[model samples]
Target: MKPRVSILAALLLVSVCAKAQDVNVEVLQRDLDHPWSLAFLPDNKSILITLRDGELKRWTPGEGLSAPIIGVPKVWAKGQGGLLDVVLAPDFAQSRRVWLSFSEAGKDGKAGTAVGYGRLSEDTKRLENFTVVFRQSPKLSTGNHFGGRMVFDGKGYLYIALGENNQRPTAQDLDKHQGKLIRLTDQGAVPGDNPFVNQPGAKPEIWAYGIRNPQGMAMNPWSGALWLNEHGPRGGDEINIPERGKNYGWPIATWGVNYSGLAIPEAKGGKVAGTEQPIFYWQHSPAISGMAFYNADTFPQWKNKLFIGALKDKNVIAMTVNGDRVNEDGRLMTSHKQRIRDVRVGPDGYLYVLTDESDGQLLKVSPKR
Candidate 1:
C-alpha cells in the first residue's frame, strides 16, 4: 500500500525551505565609472576601489565615496586596459602601504601591465612616495589582454598576472614577461630563488609560463596554495592551481579556437607534452574575473566555498571545492543583469561585489533576517 501526501503539507515544507535559503542584497553605492576592483581596509570600516578610467576612491559606511585619491600614475584607458586591481599590504595597519596595477603607456603609444605601491597619506587624499615596482617587458601595440591581477602569498612575496598582449605566440617565449605569472619580493626585487633564475634567456621573475589572460588569482586560506582563472580565445575558460616553473598551456594546447573560427592545430587534442592541464575548464567562456573564498563565519551555508565574478555571464558563481577539483554550485545577482567585475569576502564576514558599467555599483550580500 502507498501513502498519499496532502497539498497543504507540501506547501508548508516549501515555505520553510524558502525561508532557510533567503539571502539579502543591498546596493551600497552606485554610479561608479566602470569600477574594476575592491579591497577592504584593516579597520573594516572603509574600502578602496579602482576605476578603469584612472581614478581611485575610498568608501565608508558613514561618509560614502571619498574624493579621487591623487598620486596615481596616468593609465592608458584603452580597450580592456586601464587602472585594474588594488590590494592593501598584509601589514597595512602599521606600514600603510597599498599596491596597484594598471596599464602603463610606453613609448610609441604602446602599453603593458605594471605594478606599483605607495603609502597612504594620513589625510587619505593622496599616495606618498609612489613607485613603479615592475613593468611588463616588450610592450606591444594592442591594448587588450593586459592581465593585471595582484595577490600576495602571505610569505613576503607578491604575484602579478600578465597577458599575451593579443600575441598568442608570446606566451611560450620565456624571454618575455608577457603571458607569465611573475613573483617578486615585497620591495619589488626578483628573488634569487625564482624558478628560471639559473636558466638562460628566461626572465628571472617568471614563476610560471604560457598563461593567457589570467584575470583572477588568490591564495587559499586553508591550503596556502595559489589558484588562478584565465580567459581563452573563443571558449576554454580555465581554472588552474599553477606550481612553480610549470607551463600552463595556452595557445599551444587550449580547448578554445581562434576568434575567426579557425582550429588551433596544436590544441586539436587539447593536450601537449610538457604542458600542464587545467583542473577545470568551461567549454563556453563566461569571461571569469576576480574571485575569493568564503571563509567568514557569518554565512554558515557558504563556508569554505569559492566565489568568482563572471563578466559575460553577469553573475557571481559559487563553487564547491573538494581537494583539487571544483563543481559549480549556483549563481548570484542573475536577476540584476550586471557584469560582476570583482568579488571579495569583506572583513566583516559578508560578501562584497563590484559591478562593471558606466554606472557601476558596489553591492553587499548578507543573510536575511
Candidate 2:
C-alpha cells in the first residue's frame, strides 16, 4: 500500500472505533442532594439510596421517591464523613434487615466506619431498631476516605474494604484495622476461617492489608475475585486484586510519586516474592472512586465490562476485561461532573451513578439512539 493511502486508512479505522464507543446518559430525577450510595431490593420495585447528610430515600417506578428512612445513625457530615453504603442482608426478603456503613462520631469528635443494622418499617417509611454492630477501632480525627463499599461473598461472609485514612505508616501495620479488607460475620466478629485468623499480634479480622484510599471496590461475577481501585498521592492510581493475608505495596511500594514530584522509595521491587501486585494501574491518577462489573442483560453487548467513575476527569469509563487485562472503551462526560462518586449496576440491568457535591444527582444510563 502507498504511504498516503495507508495513513488515510488508519485514520478511518480510528474514526470508526470512536463512533462505536458511546453511552446515552440521562438525568433520572435530579435534586438528589449528594446521594452517596445505592442498593436494590429483591423485588426490583425500589432502590434504597443514602444521602451523605443522613437521609435515606426509596425510589420506586410510579411513586417517585418515598420519604427518607428515618432513625439513621448520627453522622459527622463534614469532610468525608456521612452515611455511606447501604446493603441488604443476604436473606433480606425474609429478614427485612439491612446493613449500613457510616462515619460515627466518638469521643473528642473522632469518626470511624461503623457497620450497623436496621429494620425497614412496614410502609418503608422508616428504619427501626437501628443498631450499631461493628465499628473500626481507634477512630481518627481526620474524617476522610472511609472505604465503605460492602459485599457478601457466596460463602456468606461479608467483605469490607477500608481506607488508609491518610495515615500512611499504619497501612503496613497489623495492629491497625484501617487500610485493610476485613472478613467478618454478619454479627461483626472476625470469622475463624479468615486468612489471618491464626497469626499472632496480627488482627485476625484482617483479610488483606496495605491499601491506601480504596475508593472503588467490587467482586467479579464469574471469578468471584475481589478487585479494587484506590487513589494515589498525585499519580499511581491502582486497581488491585488482593489475596488473603497479603500486604499490597501502598506507600511502601507504588508506581506513583509524591504530589510535589519528590521521590518516595518504590514500595518494593515490582516482582517482590510475597507481595500482591495491582492488576491494573494508572500513572496519571484517574482519581477513581466506585467500580462494578457489568453482568446485567440490559446492555448485553457490554456484559463483563468493568465500569469505573473518575472524579478528577469527571468521566465514567467503561473498560473491556479479559482475565486481568483491561482496555479503555466508551466514556460519558456529563455536565454535572461534581466528582463522580460511585457506579453500580441496578437490579433492572441499568447503570446507576452517584455524584459528590453537597447537592448532587443520581444519574442513569439509557440508549442514545
Candidate 3:
C-alpha cells in the first residue's frame, strides 16, 4: 500500500534568489560557530538551530537572524559533546513545548547524552523551564560519541539514540547506558508499552541496543519506520532499522576496524543470529552527520529520496528509498571544502543545509538550470 503524502506546494520565502536559471546559491548569512542541527518551527517561517559551541540561534528569511537565544543548559562542549538536535512537540503551536538532546558532564566529568524538554517563549525562539527528561544512568566519561538524535513515533512516544562513547564493550553490556536507542514518553518518561518494560535487569527505556556513533537518523517516508546511521572507524558505515529488544551487532561485529591501523578482531567477526543487520552499509565511510526524507514537490525529481550530509566526503548525498531499503543515487555539493554538517527538508519543497566550518553557512537548494 502506498503511503498518502501531502502535495508540497508551499514556497517558504521569496527573495531575489541568486539566479533561478543557473541556480546559484548565495550566502544569505555566514560566520556561524559550528552549527550542528536545525529544525523548522510549525510556522515554517522561522527556525531553531543549535551550535556545537553551545549556542542556539533563531533564523528567519526577511528579518535575517536573531541574537543567540539564551536558556540552553550547560553542555560539556568537548570533542563531540555539545548542543545537538532540536525538535518541537507534536502539539507545538498550542503546547509551546520542544525537546533537545545534548551532552553534559557528570560528577566524574565524563560527558554523556542528555535529553530535555522545555516550553518555547511565545516567539518560539528561546527555551524556558528546561528540565532533563532523560540522562544516561551510571554516567561514565566516554567523550567520543553520544548519539543525541530524537524522533517521535506515531504513538507520540519519543525515541532517542545514544552512542557507544568509544567504549565498544559497552555496546553489548546490558547494564550500561552506552550504545542504546531509548523509548520514552513525550515528557521523557518510560512508556509502559516498551518491549521490555517488565523484564528484570533490563532498562525499560531501551528500545534497541548496540550503536557506535549514530549521527544520521530519519523516519522512513513509506514505512514510517525509524532509520539510523552510525560511524565506522576506517570504513563500514551502517544503516539499520532498529527492532524492539534487538541488538545491532557493534564492536563485537562490524565491517570496519579501528583507525590506528590495528584491526580489532571483533570488528571483523562475531556476526551471528539474534543480531540485527544494516539495510545499507558504506565502505570508505563518509562520516555522516544528519539525514532526511525528501518528499518535496519542488524537486519532483528527488521525491521519495533520502538526503544525507557528510563531513569527510564534504558533499550532500541523495538516495533512493524503496520501502525500508535504499540505494545511493547522487552526490551534490557546492564544490567547496566546508564539511556538510546537516540536511533537512523544508516545509516548502526545498533542502536547507548547514556546513561545518569555523565560519559556516546555511544554504537552501532549489532547481538547477
lDDT of each: 0.85, 0.76, 0.78
Poorest 10 consecutive residues by lDDT, candidate 1: 1-10
**RMSD for each of the candidates:** 7.6, 5.8, 7.3
Regions of candidate 3 where Cα sits further than 4 Å from its true position:
1-24, 268-270
RMSD from true fold, candidate 1: 7.6
Which digits, one per residue and each the tens of the lDDT, describe model 3 over residues 262-305? 77656645355667767766656778889999876777877888
**Winning candidate number (lDDT):** 1
What's the distance in Å from true for residue 228, model 3? 0.9
Per-candidate clash tally: 0, 3, 2
lDDT of 3: 0.78
Using lDDT as the measure, what is the rank order of every candidate, best first?
1, 3, 2
> Each prediction's TM-score against the native?
0.92, 0.90, 0.90
| Candidate 1 residue lDDT tens string, 1-369 | 111212343234323321222458899999999999999877778999999999999999978999999998889999999999999988888889989999988898889999999999888899888899998998883678999999999999999999999888899999999999999998789999999999999999999988989988998888889999999888778888888999888778887787778886556446777888887676667789999988888878888788888899888877777777666656777777899989999988898999999999999987666
Clashing pairs in 3: 110-141, 147-163
